[model samples]
Target: MHTTEHHWITTPITADILRGALDLEHTEHGVLPHRLPARARAQCVDGQLAMAESQPSGVRLVFRTRATAVELDTLPTKRVYVGVPPRPEGVYDLLVDGRPAGRAGVTGGNTLTIDLTTGTAEHQAGPVGTLRFTDLPDSVKNVEIWLPHNETTELVALRTDAPIEPAPDGDRKVWLHHGSSISHGSDAASPTATWPALAATLGGVALINLGLGGSALLDPFTARAMRDTPADLISLKVGINLVNADLMRLRAFTPAVHGFLDTIREGHPAAPLLVVSPILCPIHEDTPGPGAFDLGALSTGKLRFRATGDPAERAAGKLTLNVIQEELARIVEQRADEDPNLHYLDGRELYGQADSAELPLPDQLHPDAATHRRIGERFAELAFTADGPFTDRSA
Candidate 1:
């Protein structure tokens, strides 16, 4: 009989741990970058740079992995996704140990297909299957994977020849996240280029992005989802969406925040959790939000600045970014006495007045690719690199 040692496995994704791991760097060079024979509505006038699949290229992906054995009968599995969501049209090709396994993924269906050539196991996305080639020759060394781009979003994780190391024994770890569209990479650049994707690249962790563009209002379902998932590293980037979506009022906010945290604790008893407030938004910088501006054409009248009164209403409705930041400090300080892993990271510190002054975001709603890069660098420095978050690789 075969034996399974269940060697420890490390998450290959180094990008965002929020919604999906946005693999921008790969998408730019892969299938989607090919700019398909089609055109996608651009997110910005300049175009979706960091996350958009503008120019597509045929690039091979390399997955450096070590395999493990199974006790018996239970086949192993590995799953690769287009990581970058809000994906446009694109094509992905898969290869194993240099063998052309085949390709799949459609703009309409959001699915994937694989041809083993050997026809071992068939996988698709819409039908959303996994392509598996088993009973190997046993001489495999490196796994080479590839995904071409489309005209929409970028690639997430390219298909792989090597599967994720067979799950280890004991407990499995997960990465949990919650945030706004920014965390969802709303209008940044490419699929893989979002800030979350960039940060994940450096973090080398599992991900579960809960970045609802207009929806992150600390909903119960969201809290339940977090509470249900088994996580190793958990983070919640609140405020931005609550402010942008104009979703809640402070009267209902404080309890919502506490309840959100409480819900997650149900699943992750002592997991490392981080709470981040919004980054600086000059439109709402000190002005408080539900920020808004009259984009209507100047009525050929005076050049006076128009006020929508929405920003004020939004601000009054919920906590200001600074307010959340301060409250987060208090929450963590109070919780720190009981939970050593609970941490608070100010979004401003990630992208605040200083960063805005240094390199501003494009639409005031989203950070530019350069800014994303900067944020990635800082996140690595503050959270991941050296002896930081990776400390609990045991997860």
Candidate 2:
């Protein structure tokens, strides 16, 4: 806490200062970052969509300030699944001069409890919480506060001992990426450790992450949002959500993929557009889904997912992880004839059977922290290096 003699300067949270978010909504308390814009959000009225969009997965506060201490006030909506172990508290990562400085978390926020069996959700109101970072070197430096990736956060106010300005843009390419919850940081230990975030850091790119949990269903509105957003590079990780949600058949999925890419092409016709298939999820690798929580694991205070659909259903056009990978590869090949910039990277290339053998997904779905680091490192080497699909055209 700063002494009274230290006059706090409050800075308004504006678009120019926010990074890795596509849209910002004015809330009663303050501004809420949305991975999908208002127009896109309006197109979907489901609870999953609501929760996913509101949670600012890769959103962060970026600025340059001379403050020795900083305080951010926020209202967060935390999710609670009924009959399961309580969720971990969200972490706020602070980076000074582009180096990891410290990590913190807030307490006492609104809780949304969802009953999986009944498909009912109840909201319990809570008070706004403050995250304070102090005892820093008193000099002008770039500062970044990566918001909690899993919680829906309303940025109420930011106060610093010194005046703050937007961080100057670097010579990095702007990489816009979209995917499901796994890409949304699922089990990644911290905000900055998410695969996409880690990849961006290694690739030296500015990330606009549009990864939405349980909601990457090839929605046209999401496609439209990506179509309109500006980016130097783009990538889409598809399939897992489609399978887990049991949202579509392969017959419908192929056309949806084409349509989504079609929309993105409307804006960036020649940008490197890499399409990634799902990572290895043994449960969904051969079996179809509607993924269900593992009751046995749940009873033991663990959260694990199991494919509920029969493996035989794949013959009926029901999509499985393996099926999606094949379809996606074919789809990308067909499109690549006309769109030379289009490329495909099988998710297995990032995390396959062998990698799984060594670093198993704790939940039999999303990767753990170490796997995230591995994927990010591999992605950088595969996609961002020379002769990679995402190699710079100008070079």
Candidate 3:
């Protein structure tokens, strides 16, 4: 709170230091983060795509500063679902020297109201918000200000009591990941607490998370984006979005998965590409989708999802979790003969039958904060270890 000897300096948010965001556009107020590139975004006009890419899940501001006090001015679009419990304020997690230092939330920002019944949303303007942290160690340290995962944040200003510079890349491999809302930090506590974020921390890698909510269908544009993004490791968590969206049948699904991987291979032929299946979601395990809101739970002020399609639809080539898993495993196994770097990870290994009994999905879809932590830990152990798919091969 004390500004008396604070030699405040505004740092330029260049692409070199910003993590998790695919693109950044300067605005009248500041810079806006976009999880998808402009070209890719231009190819889609859906509302879900707009919201998901702008939500900034896994995005963070990284730099090295000797300043002990820091203040960041931002304009966050906080979403509120009417008739249900209000979501918590977006959290800003601060890390110094790769360790947790503090956590805070912005007080004022834009608000987005959603009507579940009609699937419509309204935006309301609000004043800019600020996040401040003080009492940091006086010595030079690597500082990471992780933005809100659930809120769309516009970076207005970043001020520190001393000069700052881009943090040195400590030889960390970049991990490019693509998945659905669950991977986008849906119900997680904060941006850094997302499973991918946590896994990045444990694996000692930088992350470029392309986890778009409701938009993870096997689009060519998304595959192209992944192909062009520089990465030492790549992963795709496929299935849930496809099933919940009812986007394709078994016939289209097979070729689509192959095309998606083929596109990525065009860019990096030898990069470790791990294909992950969906985690357990009882609603869509045997049943098909398009997933619908559980009206019964909504009436009591809760948000829950249910699969609306009949289980018998599988005979007609309709996709379900079980079907997708089998196909993904087969696809990966068949590809691994020629593409030795390719691997398959059954998502159930992260959160499956036994674990679900104790830590069930609160919304009947996405995992909670505790599950996010569990998944992150499991992923780190399984994928980054010496025998895992992402093990370093440079001997």
Alpha carbon lDDT of each predicted model: 0.50, 0.91, 0.93
Residue 185, model 1, lDDT = 53
Candidate with top TM-score is 3
Clashing pairs in 3: none
List runs of model 3 lying over 4 Å from the truth. Answer: 1-5
- How well does candidate 3 match the true structure in TM-score terms? 0.98
lDDT per residue for candidate 3 within 1-395, as digits (tens), equals 85457778988777877888889989878999998899999999999989999989888899998999999999999899989999999999999998999999998889999999988999999999889999999999999999888789999999999999889878999999999998998999888899999999999898988888888899999999999998999999999999999999999999999999999999999999999999999999999999999999999999999999999999999999999999999999999999999999999999999989999999899999999999999999999987998878674
Candidate 1 lDDT by residue in tens digits, 1-395: 98433433334333221122222334322222221112211222322232222322222334434432111110111222221223333444444444445454433323333221222333443312233233334443444333322223333333333354322222323556677666655544443445655575556554445554545567675676677655678888888666644556677777888888888888888888888777777665444555443333223221112222344454455556656677767877887888777778777777877888888665557676688677766765667765664355554
lDDT of 2 at 380: 94
Q: Please, what is the TM-score per model?
A: 0.57, 0.97, 0.98
lDDT of 2 at 356: 92
Candidate 1: stretches off by over 4 Å: 1-173, 292-294, 297-307, 310-318, 386-390, 393-395
**Candidates ranked by lDDT:** 3, 2, 1
Q: Against the correct fold, how does model 2 do in TM-score? A: 0.97
